[model samples]
Target: MLKKDSLLKGTIILAAAALVVRFLGLFQRIPLDYMLGSIGQAAFNSANTIYLLLLTIATGGIPLSISKMISTRYALGRPDEAKRIYQAALMFGAVTGLLLATAMFVLAPVYERLSRVPDSAVSLQAIAPALLLFPIIAMMRGYFQGRQIMAAGGISQIMEQILRLIGGIGLAFIVLGLGWGDKYGAAAVAFGSVLGSIGAFSVMMWFARKLKKQDRDEESAIATDKAAKPSSKLPFRTIYREIFRTSIAAVVTAMTVQFVYFFDQSFFMRLTSVFYNHDTAIKVLAEYTNRAMGIAGIPPILAIALGASIIPVISSAYALKNMEEVQRQSSLVMRIVFFTGVPVALLLTVASYSVTGLLFKSPSGYDTVALLTAGAIFQITMMISNSILYGLNKPKQPMYHTFIGLGLKVVCSLALAPFLGVYGLIIGSSICFIVITLLNVRTINKEINLNILGNKWFAYLAAIAVPALAGWGTEYLVLNLTDAWANKVSYFIAAAVTSVIVGGLYLIMLAALRVITPEDVRSFPGPLRKVLTLVLKPFYKRAA
Candidate 1:
């Protein structure tokens, strides 16, 4: 039902929105880290991790399921069936979200006790209601995505992040000023999540209503006289059955990353408590997971944005049995993943201390941050590959791989964290992601000749190394030259200069190495591609 140009345009809109949301998320965490301190942050992280896990279970798979099912039916010219499926998904989301929210509220205290974070139940309870609302928002977004109209979903996401930023930061200040304890302050911050969800749900509902009106207007314009046949509408029970069947695999595959984090939340403190006091362990984790990895999480958003756009695009392509288009999209997606992911990961590694200090006001845990940043290369790969598998209708493959990866994460975390502390956790995560990425890539290769990690891979490696090495040299020189100028402000300035130098050089390297071709730039959003065209004209000429 979606034209090619519209699909590409929608993907670009969503990807751009995703980038903005990631930036807003980073801004939100800055104030949160400053206000909550280590122990308070540890408590918030504990509750938030559980909240994320439950949220994933309640809302994650259903959207993908809705998108896939609706895309398929719509491609077959079955608008009535697609609409019926949307209705079923909405009802399902409402019931499921309510049950999950109630369950989360009831179990909040138990989770706090298990994690040994004091007063975390307050935050957990505060975030529960959002679970009931997010499912509805996700379902509506899925409907729009199924229609390949991604701007609605994109704008709704931006609205959520903007509101959450304002509400969380403001509430944190108010709570602290009012002499509330850190727990209540954390809870107030958690309440911002609820507020943000409400905003998102409202925006999505508006879009859904507009879409409905458009559909009705179009139907009226056509002026069909025949009464709609009952047979045209799918049976509700049958739709539900199919949805559940697809949703099982989708839920498991989608929850892979969240489940890894959930495992850490469940066991990290207990394991660290073995080596140190409970409070001390939580403090250390606050630095490692909460702060360091928090910044490290940004690069993967590029992959996540691409993956979200890829699922429906690839699904529709595969649905039509258009192998050529499928292959073309798959190749483009993988190239973008590697070309962007590698340099960003390496840049973070090279400037970990500077960036971490600038962002979190502390230069500690650079090694942990570097290791995690390195691991994100594989994380990005795994994310995009899994989406490709899901798009190709092989969702169970990713589910099985996720199980293997989860098992590895638990085993490695328990085995390593006891001895090496936070570093152990970092190592375990890296190994888990690497193994998962390999497995997913292997399966994808068998399905289609992706030619991934061949030929141009060495060029990708060179492109990553040159700028990263130069950036590191520049930072070392600057730091050594200005040894007396060592403060957060200084680090911030150094980071800004180094980022511009590193980023500019990396782009040049990509141009020189032909890792980013003119054809590739053409695939980008119109404005971005045009800017790149002007900047890289010589490189295009050289490649030609």
Candidate 2:
């Protein structure tokens, strides 16, 4: 069984890796945005939404299902059964991948009509092949996670994103240089999705093989001891049934955000058309939703990686019926996620214009970006909460709440769009996740006396206030200081200075308030822990 210490370490590793991958993705998107402009980005995003939907459906919750099953069995001292379960899951994944890829490739034309973006058809076809490869990658990562070996998954993710950045941007520039127009350039970038999946799958397959060999060697070492009483495996049908049961709930919970975003893709242009011409509406919607989403996407990486790392650990604890451990870990994860999320959301909101201008070479959608970044607090909280629910075998609760949130999003967007324009859609996204997160938090309180709003919560709020105020001051100073400089230079200076000041103040405030202790420092990676330890030890001495 994986220890809580190992789980914490694993979460740090995954979170750090996720940060790197997100940075790479940010780099890729910045250049890609410059190349595609708002309209091409609109087409690309629309096609990408379809791909994400199919990808989510095709894999569903299979990875988490596999992880939960394996961890449960492994916790019960049934290694052989866990191995058999993984083998069967691999088969299921392969077939699902094949069918989903074929379906997407063949139905590209129909999807084009549905999305109302003709250029999306080419992008859709380019991204179709990835559906065939990613399921296997996900399954292997899940297996390693169940084994509490997070580095393999982290490594594979980094490798996948590296290849994606190189291949996608390289091809995009190649196409653009050849004078092929943004349509072809976007398609070329989409084709890189397949390459990225292939790279990740290859890396995961290598690790899976390595793990299999290690497992075999360990089994050989214990062969004599196990020979007397070998455990029997579950019936294939029974295993499949359990997998599907878990998967359906997981899929619903996991796909909530994607489905909501897909709703935006499907209706954004049409709804905006009520205010402007069709082409103009498309461009406006693209600027508001697509660009804003891209900028907003980066901050959730750490929460997502931590949530992913927590699932199998939490599942294993639940399988052992350790309610205390479950409660402790769940509360801790939520606190950590919230602590990271609050300042990020605040800083992003405060420096939205600078950040948008620096990264996208324009400040056109800064308001939307600011709103979405603030909404990320809800989004990140909901992600971690959803994982905890899944770990507790309460997946249906989150799934139901997500539907409520999605319904609210649709209704709010429809009612507010005509008057408020694209900002209405941003409102929908924010309110949807905030309501969903609150519901999830209430459920968690009942499940495990989390004390989410106790004195510690006040400390967290106080800690956040320091950085929020400092961030605004720094942004103002830098922007005013760089007024004589070029636009990009001014934005870069403001964003960079504000980021440093905000980050430093946030950490210091946490340390001073005693909200972050030595134990928390140990949860970070070695280098970070060292730096934090240095900053925190004086406080520790005073507290003692």
Q: What is the lDDT of candidate 2?
A: 0.80
lDDT per residue as tens, model 2, 455-490:
666787888887888888888888888899999999
Over 1-544, each residue of candidate 1 has an lDDT whose tens digit, in order, gives 3222376677778888889988887777777777887767776777777877877887777776788788889899788899899988889889888998999899999988887777878888988898898888888888887887788888899999888889877988899999987888888877888889989988888877777888888778885645654436678899989878878887887787778777776777777766767767767777765766577778898897789778888889989989888888888788777766777887888888888777875777677788888888888888899999988989889889888988898899999888887777778877888887888889887867785445777887787888888888887776666667757767776777778878888888888887777778898656657878898897668767
Which predicted model would earn the best TM-score? 1
Please provide the root mean square deviation of candidate 1 (C-alpha atoms, Å): 3.4
Error of 1 at 225 (Å): 3.8
- For each candidate in turn, give its C-alpha RMSD to the true structure in angstroms: 3.4, 4.2
- Mark the regions of model 1 whose C-alpha exceeds 4 Å error after superposition: 1-5, 71-83, 214-222, 226-234, 311-329, 453-463, 504-544
Looking at model 2, residue 371 earns an lDDT score of 82
TM-score, candidate 2, is 0.86
lDDT of 1: 0.80
Poorest lDDT segment (10 consecutive residues) of candidate 1: 1-10
My TM-score estimates for the predictions, one after another, are 0.89, 0.86
